[model samples]
Target: MHYKQLSQQIFKKSSYLCVGLDSALDKIPSHLLKEKDPIFEFNKQIIDATIDFAVAYKPNIAFYEALGPSGWETLQKTIDYLPKDVFTIADAKRGDIGNTSQMYAKAFFESLNFDSVTVAPYMGSDSVKPFLTFEEKWVILLALTSNEGAQDFQFEELQNGKPLYEKVIEQSQNWGSHENMMYVIGATRNEQFAHIRQLIPKHFLLVPGVGAQGGSLKEISEIGLNKDGGLLVNSSRGIIYASSEKDFAKAAAQEARVLQEEMKVYLDQL
Candidate 1:
């Protein structure tokens, strides 16, 4: 999906919510295990329940990769089952040399047909630029993340006193336009949103670490929103694993609705 279409969806749905399918096998309800592909079944139900309120769906690749070949098949099926109008993200933070990155792009954009993929920019321009070559496929580069360990490098001040993540955002703008590139700014890093927004005023941000991770939706929404509603706040375990029983889908829908309602309030202010 292009930026304009995504923006329109946010307006049409009154939401900037991206439901994260970080569906782990061990955590899903045991009843689903009876199905030949429990993961896909779980995802299908979640999508069905939340699709009306959510504008995007992100499937974190690690959860499926751990399940091996069958996991991949399940992932493919889940992608195929998703509504085309809702954006899809392969939350595979892939980054490699130019040649390998191209293959990763092809796999997600051409084969699986994801609208975007999370990418690491630690390898610099060549690693990230390859993913930007595809039309309408986004490269969500990691910036200030929510993980505790982000303090190790992302916060480190350079000789010029700029934080590492700011440098990442500043330098990367040249690689791809806001239309095709986004930054992954974790919701836990809400305090940084003001400064981060100034750095890339129009680019979309794929935010995670809300809900279960304890990031405040109000704080992030207050500081992070742009005129276009440039945010895709994601909730994973908090929504998908809301219940481990038969009420799982309903519980997920409830959680998503809560977020979407909050998002609508923010959108209305715009």
Candidate 2:
């Protein structure tokens, strides 16, 4: 989807929520195991329940890749099941040499038809620029993440005295504009939102680590929202795994609604 369309969904649904489908066979409800495709079954229900409150659905590619061929089929089915208007993301974190990155882009944007894909910019401009060639498709570059090892390098001061992530975001703006590019700013890194926004105010941010990872939604929403509603706060386990029984879908809806309502209050203030 285009940025304008995504922005319209944010207001239409009163949400900037992005539901993550990190569905794993081992973790899903046992009852779903009896189904023909357990992982997709789990994801379908999650999408159905949270569709009212979410503008995007992100399926972490690793979970599906681990399942091998069948896993890939399941991922295709999940993508096909999503509503046409909602933004679809392949959380693939893929970035390689120019040619390889082109393949990755084709796989997600052409084959699977995802609207966006998460990318690691460590490979530099050549690795990322290929993904930007696709019209209206997005490359959500990894900037300041919330992982435990983020401090090991993201905070490393560069020659210019800016942290590595700051440098990454600053330099990357040249490769693509806010229209086709976005940064992944984890919700746990709320302290840096103000500074990061200064670096790229109009660009969208795909933020994870909100609920289960203990990131404060209030702090993220307060500091991260732009005039176009440039934030997609994702919650994976907290919502999808809300229950392990037959009530899983219903429980997921309740969790998503709570976050959507909170987001509405913040968007209202905007």
Candidate 3:
């Protein structure tokens, strides 16, 4: 889907929320284990509950990859079940050489039919350019992340006196425009959000680290939002696993609604 459509969804739903489908089998409710495909079963229910509030859904690739062939089948079923109007992201963090990157792009964009895929930029331009070739697909490049190890390399100052993560954003803008590219700016790094906003004001930011990760939604929403509502704040454990009981889907909806209501208030002020 195009960025224009995504922006419209945000305003239409009064939310910029992106529900992360890090649906690990071990973490899911015990009741779902009775189903032949527990992972897909859990994801279907979660999607049904959160669809109204979320503009996007990100399925963490690792969760599906771990189960091998059966896992891939389950992932496919979950993808097929999702509503086409909602944006889909393969949280794959995939990036390789140009030719290999092309294969990855095809696998996610053509085969699985995801709207976007998260990519790592350490391999540089040639590695990432292949993914940009697809029409209406997106490459969400990693910039500043929420993990604790992010302080190790992301903050290392470059010769230009800017941090490495900032340089990643600056150099990558030449690769793909605001239309086809986004930066993964961690909600945990909200202090740098204003500066990052100045760097790429119009590009959408796929923000993680809210809720379970302890990132303040209010501060990041204030710092990261552009006139187009350029943020897709993701919540994984906080929403999907809100309850361990049979009412998990209902609990997830409540969590998503709380965030959506807060987002509407913020958007109104914006």
Candidate 4:
């Protein structure tokens, strides 16, 4: 989907919630295991329950990749089942040389038809640029992440006195416009939002680390939002795995609604 359409969806629904479908087979309710293609069944129900409250859905690629070939089939089916208007992200942090990156882009954008894919920029411009070549598709480059190890590299200060992540943001901006590119700014790094906002005020940020990770929705929303509602705050285990029983879908929907209501408050103030 185009950035304009995504922005419209955010306001139209009064939400910027992006539900993460990190549906692990081991974590799903045992009852679903009786069904044919249990993984897809679980995802379908989750999408049905939360689609109204979410503007996007991110399927963590690792979850399906671990399941092997059948896992890939399940992932494809899940992608096909999603609503076209709701943005889709292949949460596959892929980055390689130019030739390989082009194949990754084609796999997600052309084959699976995801609206965007998460990418790592550690390899520099050539590794990220191939993903930007597709029309209306997005490359969500990882920036200041929520993980504890982020301090090992992303926070390292350079001789120029800026953190490595800040430089990643400054340099990667030239690879693609805000219309076709975004950065993965984890919600756990809420304190950095103010400075990051100044660096790229207009680009959308695919934020993780909310809910289960204990990142405050209020704190990130306060500093991370732009005039266009430039944030896609994602909740994975907190929403999808809210219950391990038959009420899983309903529980997921409830959690999503809570976030959506909170998002509406921020949107109204904006």
Q: What is every candidate's alpha-carbon RMSD to the true fold?
A: 0.7, 0.7, 0.7, 0.6
After superposing candidate 3, which stretches have Cα over 4 Å from the reference?
Answer: none
Model 2 per-residue lDDT tens digits across residues 177-203: 999999999888978989998888899
Give the 10-residue window scoring lowest on summed lDDT in candidate 4: 206-215
What lDDT is reached at residue 233 by model 2? 95
Count of clashes, each model = 0, 0, 0, 0
Per-model TM-score on C-alpha atoms: 0.99, 0.99, 0.99, 0.99
Question: Model 1 reaches what TM-score against the true structure?
Answer: 0.99
The lDDT per prediction is 0.93, 0.94, 0.94, 0.94
Candidate 4 vs. true structure, TM-score = 0.99
lDDT of 4 by residue, 122-208 (tens): 999999999999999999999999989999999999999999999999999789999999999988897788899988999999999
Question: Candidate 1 — worst ten consecutive residues by lDDT sum?
Answer: 206-215
Candidate 1 structure lDDT: 0.93
The candidate 3 region of ten consecutive residues with least summed lDDT is 220-229
